[model samples]
Target: MATAVFPYLPADELKKAEDESNARELSWFLDNLQEKLAEFKHGLEDCYARLSPLEDPESSTLVISTPKSELVKGHVTRVGTRVVKGSLHLRLKTLPSLHLKLSETSPLILPQLSHLRTLLNNALDCVDITRWTGDRHSAAFITSQLHLLHSLLLEAQNVLTGPSFPVPRPGTPHPLPIASRTSGEDGNEHNPPWYQCIPDPNTFAPPVPENLSLHLIPTTSSLILTIRVLEPTAVPPSAFNKFALAIGAQRRLEHDEMDGVFMWKGEEVKVKEKVRVESGGDPVLLVLGVKLQSLEKGIEGAMMSLRAVMGLSQEKDDD
Candidate 1:
């Protein structure tokens, strides 16, 4: 077996080898998830900072109550994380709302807020890879990235609402730019394999051949990964469906038909009538609806189209 460049192993031996490989991948995935969760927790602590003041005088407030009369107070509040109605008393030890965590600290610099909004663009780049870029990755790896992306986006949102806030912990302290040809996703840095044409977010992804279309849809409770099959009429659409079904089968998949490890899943969504699949994480749940485009004799090979949509599972929202 070692001597031949392309050697074949006995069936049972091959299956055993494949099993060992899959176990290793699964182990790696779980470790990564744990690492990311730890990072997320750390980010919550890191997210603490000051909220910038706004108009309505009622709009912004000191995120951290100093419990001092002389210090600037009241008339400042975040939209959702409002200031204590009348006055915050020194005697009353009230636990600030969880949203308060987002309001943490004070005196956030305008530049820092700008940086927070920038981090989101970086997350979008991470997402685009899962859709285009045609990278070869297992569902676990992609799903882990999605979770990280979501956590990071929340951090960025604090800044976007009234000011740009940092996802400081959920991702790298300073987000790196994804290669976006002349203009990078991070705005400053441009990476390799740069091209001239920018992808249109409104329409289905432009690259139609030999590529996987990844969709990241944020739901109330959890983020849902939607992988769209390339237009079946122009392409085979086999690879895309295999990815979707493989993810769906993971939740139970008694047959053990899939090649790799079983991983993340969440509340289900109906992709097609009577066809429900997990809403969050990968393997992403997608319904491949194939319909004849044209039956005319002149039509070449076959004609079909692929469609995708996102939904939430109320019982288990990521929110």
Candidate 2:
């Protein structure tokens, strides 16, 4: 017989969990923000000609500073493609007041927008992998993105927030705890908030891209996935050179326990990230792949095996 587990947690205990989760999330965002700023600064220095259009002396930079509110906090916005040639513009807005728009050519904008989209998607993906089982962290992260994307969609055209895109919703309660909250000295309740792009259930499914393929399998504890990347014609040859997929597991070591191994008849396991970089300066793309496997054994053991495979593939790419 299977042992029974409680679904609803005690109110006090749930509150405590939320507090701890928020701290960790805030830390992750701060670290990523620093890295993003550095990359933007360096790109500006290296390609001034590519971003010249946005540097017009007549245009004034707009600032929309306001008190940090639940709906407007942690929002990031950027402008990639413009209306001209040989110029690129980038605008990053994390809050209502913080916004920048650079006027540049289409080529410059495309690459920058692509990179930014990758980063945003990667961040959300990390949150998805870590908070797969519903909790406050998952809600906070997803909520922030929804609000951010909604605001962007209102003013611009973003494929991710398009009608075809579907945002994952919380499911039945499990062992994982939901996000927590903290109280200020003045006794005000503070917790990360959730935002919806368009509250209607009808508009939730993500628009499918012609080249993107998704595979999902349900297991005893969690879901196993294999994502195959098909090269898009719009992406240049150089953009196809190096491809890396980063997997973030919620319970890093518990991966195996949740999804049992198919080959060994054991528990599921988290695979180590495998990065493949190609040789030669020419523009050739590879069929990139990401697979989450079951490892009856420990996490370290599985990663070692994956590293070996990646190394061998890299050698072949070089040859």
lDDT of 2 by residue, 1-319 (tens): 8773368678898888777776676556544433433443343232222223354431212222223322111111122222222111111121122212222221112232243234344434433433343343343443343344333322222221211212222342122111221111011111111110011221112222222222221111211222222332334434223232123222112221111111111222112111111112111001000011111122223223333433335354335
What TM-score, computed on C-alpha atoms, does each candidate reach?
A: 0.22, 0.17
Lowest summed lDDT window (length 10), candidate 1: 284-293
* Collision count of model 1: 20
Candidate 1 lDDT over residue span 134-164, tens digit each: 3324544544455555555654543332211
Top lDDT prediction, candidate number: 1
- lDDT scores in order: 0.29, 0.26
